[model samples]
Target: MPANKLAVVTGASTGIGLELARCCAEDGFDLVIAANEPAIEAAAAELRKIGGSVVAVQADLATTEGVDKLYAAVGDRPIDALLANAGVGLGNAFLGQDFGRVRRVVDTNITGTLYLIHRVGNEMLRRNSGRILITGSVAGFTPGSFQAVYNGTKAFLDSFSFALREELRDSGVTVTCLMPGATETEFFRRADMMDTKVGTDKKDDPHEVAKAGFDAMLRGDSDIVTGVKNKLQTTVANVTPNEVLAKQHRKMAEPGTAKP
Candidate 1:
């Protein structure tokens, strides 16, 4: 029998990453999933229950060494898909936040992410085939008040995804950006956004968001913002003044803005 297609998913321990992995598994792709936490092993086990091969790697995706470790785990297999979904978030005034935490967010969301994509994306280019799905956010379109750095990183990814797709247009490889809005994930708590109105508000389900992204990647779509509300938000952001947008964001993201 022929081997199944292989997919590598980062941040697969929870949320959208895990759901993306699930989508891959269900679609008959064997998976190599990585995360910065030991929960990855548990996630791997769950994926195995659905059948096909699953290798879980626990490594911090915030550093070169960690991305190297995850890359090493996929040594011989030609990757059919690469889901660059690992990222960190920070919620609070930029000046008041710890520099170390801020740096970690940037490193994970931008530096490390780019390093991994450059490595894996090049391989895909050589083969002239592969799918790359990057998890960006509609937040990229806004000036996030308390979540400035996180949104900034996503904006970079959103722009980068489209640019790379155009550069590789003739190649069989395709790059897609998955721009979801606030999701019901550990992101809010981890980012210290629990006190904000946006964090407390109802959020999109990660599974549905991932499904949209995974399907778009298979279809070679350039980008997808998963929810109707988010699509509207992005549309408005396009024409809104930056100053006004920033103020609106502050209302939703500022600390102590959560409703009773």
Candidate 2:
């Protein structure tokens, strides 16, 4: 990577996205990091300590207007890499979840994601050089049961990443998807999933997951699942019947399943 290259990472206030931004800063890339909360500024401060220019943008990635704000933050600078990692998760039976929360999940995970990719991806194509790392999930491979909306959105992202990769295969740009299993993040609490088995279960380390993803993106690999267990889960999911998968997911995701 060039010493002066610029990378834009969304969902960068905490967890995987923040770690990804740290990786970029360490690699000598100037960064434009964004999240929907004010905490993004604090994350930027930390990234700056890694010795690269860091610009923080706080915008709701669930809306086109917010996406545009992030894009505008990049100004006329060429984007050498883009990490589209903004997403939301909702737990509980799909029908029982609030409609507004469900829409937010869909908008953030799918609509805003695609819109940003469409705009930034085109610019990368015109420049004929760039890399994209999309945060997909192993959850996409199975029926989510209680996490229906979240998993459905991830399914779309997983598929979309591959299709986009093929479309840009001949271009200088490359796309990589990081399909990590659950990790140590604020995700469970935010999603109201703390009472579920999966929420209470041991998870991959955020730093390790981020490193794996950043490495894959740098290598231009098509995709990567961060851990051994996650890889096995994906393999099993591929052959399992949907009905079985749904039942299995229920054991892990159903509310009130956490141990006392």
Per-candidate TM vs. native?
0.99, 0.99
Task: Give stretches of model 2 more than 4 Å off.
Answer: 1-3
- The total of clashing pairs for model 1 equals 0
Clashing pairs in 2: none
Regions of candidate 1 where Cα sits further than 4 Å from its true position: none
Q: What lDDT is obtained when candidate 2 is compared to the true structure?
A: 0.96
Question: How far out, in Å, is residue 256 in model 2?
Answer: 1.1
Report the C-alpha displacement of residue 257, candidate 1, in angstroms: 0.4
How far residue 205's Cα lies from its native spot in candidate 1, in Å, is 0.9
lDDT of 1 by residue, 60-97 (tens): 99999999999999998899999999998999999999
Q: Tens-digit lDDT track for model 2 on 92-139?
A: 998898999999999999999999999999999999999999999999
Q: State the weakest 10-residue window (summed lDDT) of model 2.
A: 1-10
The TM-score measured for candidate 2 stands at 0.99
Ten residues in sequence with the least summed lDDT for candidate 1: 139-148
